[model samples]
Target: LHNTSDYRVLLMDEDHDRMYVGTQDYIVSLDLHNINREPLIIHWPVSQQRRDDCVLSGKDQNGECANFICLIQPWNRTHLYVCGTGAYHPICSYVNRGRKAEDYIFHLEPGKVESGKGKCSYDPKLNSVSSLINRELYAGVYIDFMGTDAAIFRTMGPQTAMRTDQYNSRWLNDPEFIHAQLIPDSSERNDDKLYFFFREKASDSGSSAVYSRIGRICLNDDGGHCCLVNKWSTFLKARLICSVPGPDGIETHFDELHVKNPVIYAVFSSSGSVFKGSAVCVYSMTDIRTVFNGPFAHKEGPNYQWMPFTGKIPYPRPGTCPGGTFTPSMRSTKDYPDEVINFMRNHPTMYNSVYPVHKRPLVVRTNVNYEFTTITVDQVDAADGRYEVLFLGTDRGTVQKVIVLPKDEMEREELILEEVEVFKVSQQLYVGSTLGITQVTLHRCDVYGEACADCCLARDPYCAWDGKACSRYSASSKRRSRRQDVRHGNPIRQCRGYNSNANRKTMETEQYGVEGSSTFLECQPKSPQATIKWVLQREGSDRKKEIKSDERILRTDQGLLLRSLQLADGGIYQCTATENNFKHALVRVHLRVLNNETVNLVLTHSGLPMASLQGVGSPGTSRAPNPQYKDLLQLLSQPEMGVINQYCEGYWQRPANIEKQNLNKQQKDKPVREQRKPRNRRNHHTSWPQLPLLANHCQ
Candidate 1:
């Protein structure tokens, strides 16, 4: 962990309360509860000869010419099979730990290192996926030194080591593996299959196009006897389509895949840079099985397009497991006929593509700056029902927390907590980056607020209002007392008797402004989804009227802006927020407008220099004073001006050159202000006051 980079969470053993992490030149075992506890570290740097050879072959000395631990699979209860890019020469070894968690000892087993040619990738930059299934390693990796030959290999078991057809573009063309999952098709062990998710260059769609794919191989396959010896006979792949339908009869496809299983949650991104986007698609195991059982894709010749095979189907279909329920008599692929093996080799691609649930993506983000790189899902049993919570990682190093409502709507909330990659296990999240790993809780329910309405409107499945503060929700708790409505997020219906601030009076702040100057009333809502409205009642009028934007008055998210204040604008303005048909007043402002005569009298009585107030009433001056001075004169009342004058006298008594240097520094360091492009600048101006600057000299 000290001298390594590119840290990846490899395995989480909850029973032992340890999480295994693999990084460059090291394999680390961290305590699940407290990562700050000294981790069990193993230093496995590449040999000097391998590093020299890697550098001589034109790989980077610091980056590519180093041992990068990539795979750590549980071989048994006491051993783990670890693999790494040993400076471009892949190697594997067995790590020894004690049989029990209490007596665990972490060390590399001596003299057990072997070549990992087919089970690991030589280059650390290339993508590979592997799963240790029943002592057999099912891996999708590039098998050659130059990283050109990619294949799915089944090795290290009692059966003969079998792989996909080597150097065959029709089988796998430049595939970048994402994940490997072992899904049991039935109760029988032989019916279990290993599925690989990847994105590769499409052979049928020319060289530039890439497509997402889901490929599977039966666990019981033992290679064919004569036709395809030492090759997979039950290997079949199908296109995974995640696309958006367009009005022009064309579909925009997302081709890069990042997948997680048990209900496949796939995060995909568009390959093209011009249309940047990412989407989350959910695929069912039933849908994937149906596509593999459908017709196979066949090509007549080199010039012909791929079409569904209409020829006579062979018995015990090409993709069927050798010892499954369909063909229990055939114990292995070696028992299959030569004709069936030959047919399987020529047609490994399924004709029908697999579509996600709802025939569309669950979440889609287009024209965004960041692409989703990884994802994890949590299925929670809320007070109402069950809900799936998605934690999506973006390339810009932030996790987006999204929850799918019962009405097929998605509410996305972002946690800008860390700039690190996220991994979820059980109820906690482990985020890792070059700096280190940090553990985060799934929900910080106290952040919602102390009010029940706030907790109910948050719509978070993990949190609810328990007649007091917001806390974690449990299904076994008193459901009728806790308030949670994830489906509608209607706080009015959920927090009827629990809202404490429902009848509280709105606090009013007194604000003074000059007749020719400007002022702003500040009010911000607690919730982002709330709608804000401003209503004003005059000093004498009893009826209140809603304020609409005009040349003099403008509304903004922060508050209401009143420019060039007039006498008619003196009133009590209330800022109200409407959410779920519930109205609440956020703030109230009582405004008082002062005329030019009153402002001039206040400045004179304050004992300030007449030179600084020269342009207050006269209009024939060559150059006006700084506008900030006018703002200061408008803001200070008669009682406060005396103290302000004392501060100003001490501020101006400094040397002239010091003031000049300060002015120059301010002019040089001031940031360029951005202006709204659509609004007319002729009447609109800044309503908020700024720091006062005295440009006029006192003699």
Candidate 2:
């Protein structure tokens, strides 16, 4: 599938060496093997060589690509539908559009065949049609008569004679339908009947109800039949979801109903007041009274009984309404109500109109609650009574994927949230509110044929295909071999190290200057061409201070930026990236920017001043000074790099060669005493304990 050019969504068919992609404009199929390991990419509909073909077709001038596509074998042959961003029109093509029905081009591309024309074509009439099957594109149209509900249409087949069917009915004349699901049993070709499902709310307040409806038309139904009476019929009617409360509010938007496996999954976007974000619910296909309740299964009394919808839909319960305020509106009868007058007041959407329905159809029928900000689309796959996989693609181009784990009795899929990402499909994921396509093509390099074991083994880790094998070097063997690193450098890579000054104790702070004086925000290892932007948020204020000068700020290679000082530039300066979206380290710098000078630092008296005195008067000493503070004096001689407190935790580190006895004596004395006598005067050594040492030293 081909989508918007940025990131394409691709489906790889390993068996056929094929890849299908959905795009922002048109879908493209390519043979995975033909492009080597490298891919020959184009904008859209535009192949590498024929880049202007789509422009020549007179549709997309700038060649905007399709944003999404869902490829399936819905018919006798493979069909591909391309949906794009802002393109009201959606297009379709068969992989074999240019080939004979028998000639199979598994991955639809133009070059597989010796020579062929491009098969893709555009269709303008398809409405808010998200899903398509074969050439028949089913859509939910919105018009004046019908509020948003659902509808299915024959997008491409030759127009048949007019008939009294839902497509042409006046009473059911609704294009506002949001979804139209073609029932599997709707092959009515033999009986000349077509069946599909959609929910209808005549007016915003016309008792907003859920109608599991099916439309049918006899092949012989003559043309120009009576106005609205000849068209559609409601097979099943009941109330839809209510009381949905999510983050924003209660959501009542019923998105789409999917029938796959043995279950029916229906999802509503943001269905709960509290949990009301976006919710997907599952209904058992076995408990399907409307479908399996017919006489064919009467002997078994509905052999497949669907479990009541108990997951989460958010429909209102009967007791939810205020005591006497409860009122349900009249539904469609033999004669449909006048849409221009009665139905217009009951539009079902939040913005357009309001429809209120009061009923406790089922428990799974109420707001199980999900969360969504402004999501309008959701999809869930179900099997049996369980939901298998969930795919919720938001209009913001976010695709939230959750997997369902399998259990013994529980066949439904469970939500595995750990696996989630806002990924970029080969192109954009959404055209507007749909999924874009991407392609993953597979290639095989004849490893055994090339048969170069030497070349393959040397390129350990990245194996060169050896005949029937890959020779990869083991880490243990490589370590033992200890060969010189002759590897080339990678253009893009990141390195990390601990933020420490010297002995692992370091504190970082910024320096400030006066109001008129210039300040320099400094970072280590400055680069000549590196640029920097300094953002300052005021100390107490929430607002950010703007930069007026471009000349002073500097960028450095050591992850620091220098800024020429100004009064307003004093708060917190955080360096931001200009070329990329990177918010570098944040630092709070207090730029005084004042008129008067302030004392910088009195390293001598600021905290605890260290004074080291050498024996200047005499070189010889007969007695030892004392035993206390012997090592402490030595430590005080080193330069101070940070705040110092003698009693601070883990502050003392004695000389590595000092004996434990000497260390204990220095620590326990009332005050530390140090031996200041000359090293050679041991013959007349005198020792004074702790406190008296200081007093005797003065004599």
Over the stretch 536-558, how does candidate 1's per-residue lDDT look in tens digits?
A: 99999999999999976889888
Using TM-score, give the best candidate's number: 1
All candidates' lDDT scores? Answer: 0.78, 0.31
CA error at residue 323 for candidate 2, angstroms: 50
Error of 2 at 663 (Å): 39
Cα-based TM-score, every candidate: 0.83, 0.35
Tell how far residue 464 is off in model 1, in angstroms.
0.9
RMSD of each: 5.9, 23.5
Query: Residue 246's C-alpha lDDT in candidate 1?
Result: 89
